[model samples]
Target: MPGGVGYLLQHCGAFFIRRVWGDDLLYNSIMKEYIEILLLRGHNIEAFTEGTRSRIGKLLQPKFGIMKIILEAVLSGRVKDCMIVPMSIGYDRVIETGSYVNELLGVPKEKESLYQLLSNMNILSLKWGRIDISFNKAFSLKEYIGAHTTRRGIPLNPSTSKIDRDLLLQSLGYRILSDINKVSVIMPTALVGTILLTLRGRGVGHDELVRKIEWLKKGIEMRGGSAADFGGKSTGWVVDRAIQVLKDLIGQRTDLLEPVYYPVKRFELSYYRNQVIHLFINEAILSCALYATVKQGGPIHVQRVKINPDLERDCSFVSKLLKSEFIYGPNGLTENMMKSIEDLTSLDVMRIDVENGTDGEVKYLSLSAEERRIGRETFDFFCFLLWPFLETYWLAAISCFALIPQTLPPIEPTWVDERVFLDKAQFLGKTLYYEGDLSYFEAVNKETLKNGFQRLKEMGVILFRKVKKGNENVTMVALSLDWCPKTALPKPPKCSKTGKGSEEVKSNNTIFTSIFGGGKPEPKISLDGTDTPQDYFDETWRYFVPEGKLWELCEQIGRYRREGKNRRDTATVAARVLSLASVTGALLTESDGTGWIKKKTSKL
Candidate 1:
């Protein structure tokens, strides 16, 4: 089957490799030998550290397999020295955007095939605006190991089965990914996507959108990031070109533009938006912290607001809450918060005051009412960047309530399969959007849900376990026993008729409770039979498989055959019975071994 293009690639030095999940001794030995030969022959090797393409445009966590292999080669003296060059490639449009959207929507990804490749060849004529590639200065692996050597003057050797060696590999992988993100170019499509998505279901005037694009470009540049060049073309031209490239996903009104296809296309737009999310992440965190302060009855005084412990604490909490989503520099959270404050002050959006305190010289942040009024546009820009992420986390928190039992102290904790939980979360998110309880539709994303799940686990609010189901190991989740729902979950925003301010509508409790919260009244089913609060949920959210019926049918078929009855006819009857039983739904109770009691059903 390796013909045509595959043959050409193989001839061009491409080789097949498989993911080594276990101790695949033979495969590992062959790969290690192949890599060593390449290094010894002075041939340059290129690898995608992430191991696979990210469904979202953001940089995925690095895979350490090949990296560890290369490191071992150098450590074993097979390769004298190897320079690691990190590279970043940005695209104006990704060809797989549509498939990525489908995958996010719970559609299983299709495996690659030659037929699909040939069918997609027509896309070669499509206008993909620009591709920007940047490479970071190469760092010598030998030198890095030498620099990190312990006081004992011992370099990291693969032969040593110590934790330090593993730590070194992890740190090295993160450094490479960080360097790649640093040099990533901000394309016009990414800028346009960020602006349009920020507006969210609203239309923007062409001139206004273009102005915002220019403003965002300036902000990125000010933050020590690069914007793609447009060959001296005006901002309007850049906007027009980007729109033209994305015309299918974007739509036009009289004099305004907006994203088409509602939530699905929003995922595609978010792909571009995530490319440059790192650039504005710090400002976004600060903006979220400031918003939280205002929501908690702490007014932002025009004169001054203390920034030392309180503001720093809030910022650190926000950063940690989103730690799974964004990558912070090696400087850590406090340092990054201070830098963001300095950046904001330099931009004249806020002023700083140095005050002599009992402990030391404390700093105060002040936003002059006059300055705020003048720079409202810039201030809103930063705050809007964080709205989607905050909304996503809020949705994720609310979805957890569905997993809890109606009783104050349940007989036993209920554990639901992780896949079922996320499916229910997505369904709940869509229902909320329709009912106006949720604002950002894009927040109902699969990737963000997974990331939020990881963050919740890190915060010790949720516990995960693996259980064997059928032939697969299913990941199951349950609320932590030590965690109380009443004090942990964020308060739900008031209904739409309340006319609450935007800040109040999205405001959460302490940053700790903000990402995950508990203690709300049990949700009620709507009056309409079509919608139920617990439609996707039950005492046990497990699917019914009717395994007993199928086995019984097999026994009957075997008995009929022994009695000299028509074996083929008996098997057909069993197949019909199995098909009918598969479609029947049944409620499972604690006595059925699910270990969770069902709440009494009631109409709203």
Candidate 2:
């Protein structure tokens, strides 16, 4: 905040909190006193539990600093009972969508300033559709604590110990967030974005888009979630309105609707989709579990399928894998899976059977002929809701392997800067997408990659260490000491300058020359250049260089340019080499009059 915003906030009884407070005994004391005084004086205090707005449109984990201060004030008898209200606000069109997309694509967020704020004021003229706001019923903080601890037969009181107080704070934080999520209004834009992003291919029929939107709305409502009501407007009208409002991202082509700038614009749409993603997380987990079971040779088919006893395990595994991406209920993974199963059963998409076994009654889940048909039809839709996240995790995992050295016995603890690791993961994601290996383009998101990295760290698959890089401390990621790949890692593709026969090169010489204009033959260097063996890059002089070798090539190019080589010819050759190698966004330029190839931060 800048200019009058800070002044206005202060005048409105808002107190600023420092993110980094060094030796803040006095600051903390004053803050605690001010909060307690406000509570005792019967002043309503509104605090954002998450501390800041989430760039991805989902609820971020709560920050406990202010919450801790407030709770201590109430629990220590400094203040009487206080009411906690969970508030959720949803937007049909976010004004900051472009900036959010930019940040997700690796661009650093711009600091707030008066000039920037004024320059962006033109957004007020845009038709942003509906802004749905919901505030859940307030609850007494003391009663909430008592209710939570009553079942454990250990009541939380003013004299509760530090451990109990901390535990209560943690639970209370999540409980408030869960309530906020529960009451979040699913705007039409959110529904439309979710459907469009989940659907395969670039184009969708107008009728088909509307149909899916309707189906998604019904499904969300069935899950006890509410979609924004447009005064009894028809589903088609809602679709049209959403399409109109999001026209910048989505284009209408006669009877077809397609994303305007695919892959890039998908990130923008994902921001809206993420708003309602939590409502579908359980179903997505169940869908993934079914797929995992099938991949493991379980009896699964279109007509009918018998659920394996390991279904629960599979669901828990999938949920744990996505634990960082979504918030799950406190009822535990198994309990959540059971609830999803019950929901599906109620919808007649599946059924359960109780049978007597040696260990008493056992329950088995199964899908009948008709139910299996319905399940199959809906399975892909549910899976689509989570496919982007899975793709992000998969890319993150592959980048870990990609970062490791290619050797007989792999490097023990290969480490890379966290920023570089994310960049590589995003680059590989785009490469895979262009090569048709990855389907979901939005998986190249930075936030999702960060979440995946966090989840991997939590799972002990990777370790994070801080190392000084220049003036700043950078986080370095490495494989955990105890972690081992289940299968042997693949060796890096070998490269050779003369590996491709001259005859083969001659055969494709015309096509290659036409694509990249023929230039004077370059003098051979002492560098060990290797030919790419992949069919995608079969042309001679083009190679698939690994990350380590890629940098060497950049240095080689720089050296050649320094030797007074033709700038156009040098850049042309470099571009062709990197393009075939699938590093599309890299730019070869003269930085400070020194020829250097630098990669520009971009999304796929």
Candidate 3:
């Protein structure tokens, strides 16, 4: 069977991408044993059955390549007692299923690609399931293949009977060699499907997830399927068995059973759940169908169609169209069409609703008689273009969102690094720093937001659908590109205001500034403002400082602001002023009168 043993070996064959066909690696002396093994085994004819990946428990409809090759061998009279017995060998676990799932989804692997190579290195393999090998009864080839070679189980000669051919193929499809219910797939799939479905759309807490899992055991029993059947654990034990399998698969923590108070482990639960998600489609079509609904989410938007004269006709038109398509388009208040419309109300996508009134005796309510419009796209026209495209991409979009954590290029410097300059990027759940912060430039907030849009578009995170909040705060600012090698955390600045970070700066301020400044001579301020490059000095200084306060000083003040909340202390103000004078020599000299700028002080 394709999904059986043939599928497992085919998976092995598929790993050697691009080295097949004309490549000598397979047929040549390089991997001669590998090729010989195939020929020696009845599977030597070498045709990969596509349907094996899905919809079957064993080898599927045989393709012509293997049959034709065998026929040629028979024609040349090289075959004597050729008996083909197809065997299905299921593994305890598929080691490299992350790739396997992709293949099933119609994304064939191109092994020659560099990105895939890098991706493979990082992939955490989920452990295999128990091996279940079912061998089909052997078939003799002499009578069938001697004179008239039957390909695809259909005889070629005009005199040959079609009825006989059909029976032969049907036997090949349905004959059970040795079926193993112990490792049959339905259990693993059903167990996982139940777990995920119970997850609903939100992540449950550890305690709650456990309780719900226990609840599922009873529910599954009530539903006429054993909760532990696919997973093949004792009754009410699937959860433990699954976790065990996952723990074994990951090979990270061997001690999985050590008090798993949570349904899954703290850090590793996501990985286990994701493994289930990987096989979601292949396991069961009903499960996949549930996933389809979950993929779309609750509803798009809910429109209350008022049953009116002209509007009724429009509603009927929409209802008829929706009904034809099998989307729930019931006439009353509870139609799925209205529910879909309701889903859009929360997320800020563009949409419109219209209403009109009539005289009291014949008055009624309904949707707009005129077609719904968004700029130029009518509602019907929009759904017409939208439905099929959404149907295709909706799964992709869900997986995109679900797999966001899995695929995220590991943030090079995870924490806020001074060298990296993005001190904090994540707050709560959403990304904290806007892309403009990384771009670092002097631009209007709008331009910064626009830059953020471009960068995020490249990142392919969320779309630029709508900006609900923080649009003003988000801006493009070139993050400090200057590097500071971290030998250790800097000592605190001795200054009254600055924190520990300022000490390193104060000790080697001149040397450090010179190195980073690239020999740009420090302005020689005369207090007279003569040839001072005060413009350059002031700009660079202003770039570093804000409102004449050094960045470090501002940081200290921020700390005080957080802890103190009120500047109620009198001495604190005076000490800070004196400390500023000590740091800035300009405070000591009288103003030259060229531009008299008085510095604030705690004038005691």
Per-prediction count of colliding residue pairs? 7, 3, 37
Error of 3 at 391 (Å): 7.0
Clashes of 2: 3
What TM-score would every model get versus the actual structure?
0.75, 0.75, 0.29
Give residue 222's error in model 1 in angstroms. 2.2
Off by over 4 Å in 2: 1-4, 21-27, 153-162, 200-203, 255-264, 294-308, 351-368, 371-375, 402-415, 467-471, 484-491, 494-604
Could you tell me the TM-score of candidate 3?
Answer: 0.29
- Model 2 scores worst on lDDT over the 10 consecutive residues at 584-593
Q: If both were scored by lDDT, which would come out higher, candidate 2 or candidate 3?
A: 2
Which consecutive 10 residues in model 1 have the weakest lDDT in total?
A: 581-590
Tens digits of lDDT, candidate 1, 285-329: 776676554423344563355687777776776777677777777
lDDT of each: 0.64, 0.64, 0.29
Taking the tens digit of each residue's C-alpha lDDT, what string does model 3 give over 182-284?
1223334234323433331224343444565565445334323232234444433544555455553322232554332323321122222222221211112
Badly placed stretches (over 4 Å) of model 1 are 1-8, 23-26, 150-161, 255-264, 296-305, 353-362, 405-413, 484-604
